[model samples]
Target: MEQLFTLAGIAIGSSGLSAIVVAILNHHWAKKKNSSGKLDALVEAQKVLMIDRVRYLGSSYIHDGEIALEDKENLAEMYQAYKALGGNGHLSTVMAEVERLPVAEKR
Candidate 1:
């Protein structure tokens, strides 16, 4: 009877430990998932901001009918980043237009 009680105690202890481990793993997974979601949101927001800046710069250059070499370089960098962040082809068209513009001479 004593051995039976010992075995029961061990079984109970093992079950409790298993439950605790499962709980900890679940909590860790939930935290990681939440962090991933936040990161995705941040990336999407950054992509939008990049798109806006690219459009603004591209439009400015296109409207002016010329882009300074420095401005063109900067715009190219911005457009590259925007494209890296999954920006659409519409901006590609705008960038092409900007690319065709004459380079302005520095005063």
Candidate 2:
């Protein structure tokens, strides 16, 4: 009975040690995985929004020149898409955060 208890304690200690090592390794891996350029999706999305802002100015009366009605229509579609994506105002904070992320890295 004494020998059996010793063996069981050794097994439990090894199991705890193994679990700790695996947890440390997983945290390291996760940190690296999130560092990829995955965040570019958001950056590119922001870039697209900035361009549409310009288009909005050009198409609406803001430019003082009447953009072709077709151009105006296209601008509307862009605006709608922008709105669907939480809109320019909603992304203001997100854009700031995205800008902080390394342009070469992901979120």
Q: After superposition, how far is residue 13 of candidate 1 from its true place, in Å?
A: 1.3
Each candidate: what lDDT?
A: 0.90, 0.58
lDDT of 1 by residue, 1-107 (tens): 99999999999999999999999999999999999999989988998888888888899889999999999999899888877877677588888998899999999
Say which candidate scores most in lDDT. Answer: 1
TM-score of 2: 0.44
Predicted candidate 2 versus true structure: per-residue lDDT over 1-107, tens digit per residue:
99999999999999999999999999999987776556756866765865557454543443343444554455556555676655556434433333233222222
Query: Which stretches of candidate 2 lie above 4 Å from their native place?
Result: 6-14, 17-29, 32-52, 59-61, 88-107
Mark the 10 consecutive residues where model 2 has the least summed lDDT: 98-107
Best by TM-score: 1
| lDDT score for candidate 2 against the true structure | 0.58
Clashes of each: 0, 2
Quote the positional error of residue 3 for candidate 2 in Å.
Answer: 6.4
lDDT of 2 at 1: 100
